[model samples]
Target: MTLRWLLTGRVQGVGFRPFVYRLAREHGIHGWVRNRSGQVEILGQGRTDRLDRFERALTDAAPPTAAPHIAEREVLAWQQLEDFRIETSQAGDRPWIQVPPDHFACPDCLAEVRDPTDRRYRYPFNNCTQCGPRYTLIRALPYDRPNTTLSGFVMCPACATEYRDPGDRRFHAEPIACPDCGPWLSYRPDTAPAPAAEGEAAVEAAAAALRAGEILAVKGIGGYHLMCAADNTDAIERLRARKPRPHKPLAVLFPDEVSLLRREVNCSEAELACLRSAQRPILLLPRTPAPSLPESLAPGLGELGVMLPCSPLHALLLQAAGGPLVATSGNLSGEPVLTDNAEADARLSDVVDGFLHHNRPIQRPADDSVLRPIAGAVRPLRLGRGSAPLELELETGVPEPLLAVGAHMKNTLALAWDRRLIVSPHIGDMGSRRSLEVFRQLVEDFQALHGVRATRLLCDAHPDYTTHRWARESGLPVTPVFHHHAHASALCGEHGIDEPCLIFTWDGTGYGADGGLWGGEALYGRPGHWRHLARLRPFRLPGGDRAGREPWRAAAALCWENGLDYTPPVTEPSLLRAAWQRGLNSPATSAAGRLFDAAASLIGLLQTASYEGQGPMLLEQAAAGCAGEALVLPLLTEAPPWQLDWTPLLAHLRDGRLPVAQRAADFHASLAGAIRDTARRTAADHAFTRVGLTGGVFQNRLLTELAQSRLQAAGFEVLLCRQLPCNDAGISAGQVYEHLGGQRGED
Candidate 1:
């Protein structure tokens, strides 16, 4: 009997063909395996029992990175063959197959690099079938070496022999190379060319420069990263000055697990597993008491963004440095990470002290992905580098192909087709022309790679956002989804919820249907069909958008509403009162984020925000150890649009007798009470027992914990963001969900 099989999923670049060949040979079957149009295809002729065993083995024992499922199977005419052979890859018109994500260096490869007796001793690019770069080096589909950045390099005789031998581990590894035929490393100073060193010498030079308090722009698998000693405050300060980033925390490359533990970092089993996963993203782990690391590294944050080295090159550099090093994106603030060598030399020369250059070319720049352990799942915050080109399978399918253009901040794009939603990596805020162009390119690249011709586009209702504008002008059928609705729908879709639930969507700002700004929202229903049930009392935002930059304006607005006298000495209280009264530049908003900013400013913790969500983050910090009781607030539960009145809470916060720390802690507790009370009343009235917490404010661990505890105690099943982020990065996924639901007439 002869059989033909077509397989799909991540089966192209992950050594699936070689695994099949070996399995077939082990079964003594006559067959052939090859890649065709982003999938694996097989034709076999053998005894029925042997073929059945071969099929079982193929299903049970595939490559680590591949999850292949049979797309088609056909009984073929018998053409008895002698032995199994791996054939050449066949190209097609469209590459719709899943592209491989970057992988962490496997243990076997790592051991070979550090072992003196191994042929690839200390080799930075030593990789076999189990591990290596895949997405970053790949240029097109049918993932062969000629289609990657290593197309120009010819393999040596020894490596070629290993590639053809089915018994060898490097049988079909596309990135298989050695020192004689692989890319070499070199160290070049800013003003002078250092000695052209290869292998261990170049890595040592880079490490020495880092140890001596100099910043080195080192190229890795995805892109370049700026490296400096973590303990050297001078080097960190210099890097901060050069990059000009004021307060955002930088990720650190820990030398080993022991080094991270010495700094008083606690890693739970889930966090540890995420750190050691194939997609080695930076894990946000909580800090322990009496921490040894300098406070300047993270400034007011409680958790540290840390990661072990993912590549052999990174491992070698960290091993030589003997300590942790601050590893930040290579480019300056607000620009994309630098990938090209000449571009790095031209654009990053003024910022970096030296360059640890390599010959491998990066097809695109991908920032390191970040994950946080929350609600028992390692949630993705910034989906890039090792965990990008994300394919999420939806419970239902869409009628037509669609693209979801995400929000203005933490932007990402999604393409939905055939029950699969493909999300792009985290694109930076669309504030500059460069970032906007990059967003456009990402949309185009994803479409080209996945063979998606989007017939419809979905965007946020906010008119001024760059993402919304781009989608509207794309000459496709555009649908505008409300920001809070998008958030609620994304959570519902991620959990595959088809029933009504109470959703609390709280964040900084979103365009509301009432011609005002909305953030603190309570909705009832399922995806694509939700009704706004309640909101926090609306307050005027003095000076409109400027109030977001200055937290004191929000404080003044709240004080003016409560008939208070003080305004924290920011731009005169009378002027802000006039703006609020006349409705000149003031716009009314019901944003819970503004409430946090108001509370923070009232307690004198943050008057001006250095970054987005800075005030609320600092407020959480100040509330760390206080055990004060929560102050009760009034709740208006009579009408359909219930009000969470902040008047009584604000009055108590303005009291002179309370300590600032106690007030901050009380404010957090008070807000938690308000959410709990609102959920209780709304859930009882609507008879809904499930609640989903979404939006950017859910990133706060304290608030999330408080809300989850209170809601669960009230006998409600709580759903928090487990896969994607709670921020705007996950908005595209929500948009796609809503659109798909609308297609099925469920809206």
Candidate 2:
């Protein structure tokens, strides 16, 4: 019997062809396997029983990193063949394969690097078929070595032998290389007085500089990382001063040893598994109390962003440093992560004491991915590095190709055609010219790589957003999706929730359907068709966008609105009050995020936020381990569109008699109760049992867990973001979902 099979899904760059070759040989089958555009094709001839086993094992015993499924299978006339072979890849029309994200150094490869007798001992570029760069190196589809950035490096005889051996782990590994034939590393000191170094000595010198409390810009798998010893307060302070990032938390890269990682942060079994997974994303775990590591690493926060070394280079650096290192992105403030060596030197020369350079070129920049364990599951906060090019199948197909340019902050673009959706990695906030350029380039790159040309574009309704403006100027028809609606839709689309559901989208800011700024919203129904069911009672934000930076402005707004006499810590309070009364620069907002900011300020947790979401983070930190009763937040349901009044909670937040921690905890409880109450009333009226919590505010673990538990206890099926983020990073995906054929609600 002869059979042909077509396999799709993460089949390329994951040793799928080699695995099939071995499987066919074991089954005594005569066949050939080759990679096609976006898929794998296999032909086999064997006895009926043997063929059955082969077919079953094709998916069951495939490579660990491959998620293969037979897309098509057919029986053909028998043909005699001597043996199975791996054939060359071909480019087919309509390429639509899942681009494999960069994988962390596999255990086998790591073992090889650590083995003293091995040829690849201490080789920073050691990689096997099962692990290494894929998306960041690939220039086109049909993922062959010639299509990658590593094509310039010729394999040595020993490496070439291993590459052709089916039994070898390095078989067909595109990025396979050694010290003799692969890219070499060099270290250059910023000051001419210090000596330069090469190879292992380069790593040593970099480590020595880090130990001496000097910052070093070290190149890694996807881009350069600005690194320094985590325990060195002076180094951290120097990095902070040079980077000009005062309060935003920095991610620390620990040695591969989990034991060492556990000393700094409290890790659960699930978090440990995620840390050691092939993706190796930075997991936000609770920090150990009284940790020896500097408090400046994550000041005023209960959690730390920690990651295991994702590459051999990172592992070597961590091992040489003899301690944890702050491995933050190599870029200027408000810019995308730097990828070019020349650009890094030109921009960051003054910021670092030395440079650890490598000849291995990165085709693109993929910053480290970030995730957190929430509500019994690990959820992505920023999808990058090992979690990008996220592909999803739509429940309903679209007729034409389209692109979604995500919101201003946490920008990520999405391309969709037929039933497939491909979301780009996290593009930094579109606040700077460099970031906007990256966003535009990413959109073009995604369309080109996927071989799909978008005829239409989806953008947020806010006309002032850079993405929205770019979409309008792109000469393609544009669909303006409401900001909060996109947040709700992203949640609905991710969970395949087509049924009428209520989604609470709480974020910092999104342009509302009614032209007001919305952050706290209860949207009913599904994608495409959504009804504004309820909202947080509107309040004015003095100083417009400046209120987001200064929590005191939000607090003052709450005080003035609620007729409270408490004074806000800001200059010219009387003038600000007059502006509030006259409605000069203040904009009306129902944003739940601003409510948190106000609560944080009123409780004296934070008066000014150095970074976005800082106030809420400090509030959450203060509320940890404290239990408080939910204050009464009236549910005003007299009208069609109801309101959850936050007025009653303001006084409690201002009460000095209550402990600040208790107030913070009570604020979270009260908001959760309000969400539950609003959901109950909406469900009672509409007979919808499913409720979703989405938007940037849902990134708050305590609030999301509390809201989820309350809703679930009230007999509602709760839906939360599991794969994609609940923040604006997910807005692009939701925009694509809106056009995927859904019942249209009232405009």
Which candidate ranks first by lDDT, i.e. highest? 2
Model 2 lDDT per residue over 200-312, tens place: 88999888888888899998877889999999998899899988889899999998777778888999887898999989899999988767798899989989999999999
Model 2: what TM-score? Answer: 0.98
All models, RMSD in angstroms: 2.2, 1.6
- Candidate 1: regions farther than 4 A off: 91-96, 193-199, 571-573
lDDT of each: 0.84, 0.88
- Which number leads on TM-score? 2
Error of 2 at 431 (Å): 0.8
Q: Give the TM-score of candidate 1.
A: 0.95
Clashing pairs in 2: 529-745
Model 2 poorest ten-residue lDDT run: 738-747
